[model samples]
Target chain A: IAGITQAPTSQILAAGRRMTLRCTQDMRHNAMYWYRQDLGLGLRLIHYSNTAGTTGKGEVPDGYSVSRANTDDFPLTLASAVPSQTSVYFCASSDGQGAEAFFGQGTRLTVV
Target chain B: TQLLEQSPQFLSIQEGENLTVYCNSSSVFSSLQWYRQEPGEGPVLLVTVVTGGEVKKLKRLTFQFGDARKDSSLHITAAQPGDTGLYLCAGWANNLFFGTGTRLTVIP
Candidate 1:
């Protein structure tokens, strides 16, 4: 299996700009998630989807948005980038709630 | 926010040595998982412990979940240089909450 793949492996943006991090999984999982990993900190959830069409806000969703249009894709959007939003973003998918979650390679974003 | 804490943030040891990494939480979870990641890559699942007081082994690595379902540990026996990477523990709350991660460096 191709497992999980994330787009724009790394990016640099100016403040107030917009960006979207893309994630796709071929595992056909029902739950998809977005998380941000900061230096020396644990992975913090940004958003999640229970299935193809449902999405929910997570711990750190203030400046981010997400969409789950199908079983294979989840895109996380940063509406207005800020320096505090600079972190590596990870995408994960699980077959069911509380099940094993497979993660994508993650996108390293830097907002200047 | 549900938090997963990992201990000994960083560890460095000789090739034949052993070490253990821990992940603890204050909330209950149905399942706990362990993952390993190298520089610039996504985490890869290592083991999943579902039952309370569960124990699972993957080669030289042993994984255990606390009886209360809020803690877990990963022990590596006779570590190798290839084991050098970031080890992370995760549990599902609303989604997956990853631990702070233990960066291990096994020297030859």
Candidate 2:
């Protein structure tokens, strides 16, 4: 069973281009999160959704957007990519607040 | 933002040696979790500590939570090459905040 699946395992895009990272979970978790990992700077939250139809800004929300259309899908989009946005992105989910989280493999994005 | 700070951003130890990694925070939390991420993969939950001053063990790894719920630690007995990875500590407030991370390398 695929707990969480992320698409485009790796991508390289030019600046000003639009890109979307897809995340899907078969666990039916209510809470979903998007995080970016970089050297020295651990995992920084980009955006999160407590439940379907709702989304919230995280610590590093700028330059990114997320949409939770249904329980199983939460997609993060970059309106216009920038070089500084290059990082490994991770998608995670949990049953509810404060519960154990499950993470996806990751998406390596390079904004050149 | 409530920050969780982990000591020794990088660690290299010989196999069969014991090591302890720490995570400290000024803000209290209801619960804390530890995760380990191997190269090219996302972080995976290793353990969760809820009660203050609680300790849990998984094989050779032992996890402890501070009495104030603001700190935690993970001790691995007899480090192995398989245990090499990036270790992170996280706490849940409004959202999950992760520590800088401890990259451990176990050399044989």
Candidate 3:
């Protein structure tokens, strides 16, 4: 069973462009999170959804937004990409708070 | 904001050598999790420690949570090339906070 899936395995976009990273999970988890990983910076949470129709900002949420329209999907959108946003984005889901999380194959994004 | 700090940002050692990585934080956590990520892939869960002073083992890897619930450690015995990856520790407060990470390379 595909636990979690992330789209656009890799992408390169010019600055000021718009991009949306798609994530879907079949585990029916109640909590989902988006994180960006960079060299020496580790993984920083960008956004999170507690459940369907509820989203919250994370440690790094300035240039990104997320929508949780349903329990199976959480999409992260960059209204206008910037060079600083170039990094590997990961999508994760857990059964509930403080539970072990399962991550998807990351999306490598390069904003030039 | 709670911050998790990992020691020895990078480690490279010969195969069969034993090593330990640490994850420390000033704030207490309800639970702690460890993950390993290889190149071109997302971090995969390794283990989770909930009770303070708990110790859990996975094959040759042993994980321990501090009695105060503010720190944790991962120890690998007789490391192999297949164990090379980025190791990260995450603490769960109201939300999960990740450490900077320790990149481990085991040379065969």
Query: Candidate 2 residues A1-112, lDDT tens each?
Result: 9899999999999999999999999999999999999898789899999999999999899999999999999999999999999999999999976789899999999999
DockQ of every candidate structure = 0.67, 0.69, 0.70
User: Which candidate wins on DockQ?
Assistant: 3
Better of 2 and 3 by TM-score: 2
lDDT of 3 by residue, A71-106 (tens): 999999999999999999999999887888899999
What lDDT score goes with residue B5 in model 1? 90
lDDT of 3 at A51: 93
- What is the C-alpha lDDT profile of model 2 across B1-108, one tens digit per residue? 428889889999999999999999999988999999999888999999999999999999999999999999999999999999999999998778899999999999
- TM-score top scorer: 2
Candidate 2's C-alpha runs over 4 A off are none
**DockQ (0 to 1) for model 2:** 0.69
Q: TM-scores across all candidates?
A: 0.95, 0.97, 0.97
Off by over 4 Å in 1: none
Task: State which candidate, 1 or 3, has the greater DockQ.
Answer: 3
